[model samples]
Target: MTYDPTFDQTRLDQLADQCLADNTGTGKVIFLSDDEDNRLELTSWRFEDEEAKARLMKSDFKLYLLELLDTLLVYRAQHKQPNASRGVVSVCKNQMTVQWVSRAEAERLRDL
Candidate 1:
């Protein structure tokens, strides 16, 4: 599958907006996709006053995230290394980062 730069940028923008709306303060959201099991795990943290911190529920943003993930999967399937078992997406404000993880790395993250 060819990479769709336009689709990816749009979905990523939407995801960033969703995160900003859901978080009351500076926040970071991490999404982990387990390709082997077809699962997506989300972890979100909100920081306030450099002291107060809380984990935010990501249910409301799942749809947007899934859309982004689906697009990424298509692109990844065509280009990723065989050993890559997980896709990691990290978002903060309007910035986003994506990377592939090995099965062992995915498991280690899940344990944390």
Candidate 2:
């Protein structure tokens, strides 16, 4: 996934919380602004505790993260386009990373 390191943590993290559907939710991925070269920017979500990882990993955390991220993205996309929260997002019990891009950016990623 491609990304920029300059994203606003507050907003990106808001998207992360939005990704989780629950305030207690931890891991997430969200879109950010594009670079001057037009590449998609990215960010990853993470939990703060080892116990949290242990609990989340007990199940298919990756699958759950993907499902949750997709749900959040589609939900947001309905209201926003272009930088419509599309891109590559990954999660483990420990970390989640998402590339921020347009719908076309996600499409290009799929083609890869």
Candidate 3:
């Protein structure tokens, strides 16, 4: 059996905005747990903050943003963007972190 509870896209977007306001990128993961035995593995990607910022300020950033936008559009098409019904359930944990290039992209991940 599988269960998935959608999250509030607006909240995710707001979180992303907060991160951007701090000049940072962010990501989120939703853990669905009830009574189950399971294990999860997550792979991470990282970059030097200063270098990433420098790159984002260049012409290439447009292409990068476009790609991200395309992805978000696809996600929205597949599943309607969630409403503000669910609050974020978890914060950064286990020394793991996420960073998003844009708030819209983060909203796309709200239900995942």
The C-alpha RMSD of each candidate to the native structure, in angstroms, is: 4.8, 10.7, 14.4
Off by over 4 Å in 2: 1-59, 90-93
Shift in Å, residue 77, candidate 2: 2.5
Off by more than 4 A, model 1:
1-10, 18-59, 80-84
Candidate 2 lDDT over residue span 1-112, tens digit each:
3342333333335444544342333543443333443333443434455565455546454355545555545544444434545555544323345555666755555554
lDDT of 1 by residue, 29-50 (tens): 3345545544444433323423
Clashes of each: 0, 5, 2
Name the best candidate (by TM-score).
1
Clashing residue pairs found in predicted model 2: 3-41, 3-42, 41-100, 44-96, 44-97
Q: After superposition, how far is residue 1 of candidate 3 from its true place, in Å?
A: 12
* Most lDDT-accurate candidate: 1
Q: Which rank order by lDDT, best down to worst? A: 1, 2, 3
Measured against the true structure, the TM-scores of the candidates, in listed sequence, are: 0.53, 0.36, 0.25
In model 2, the worst 10-residue window by lDDT is: 1-10
Q: What root-mean-square deviation over C-alphas does model 2 reach?
A: 10.7
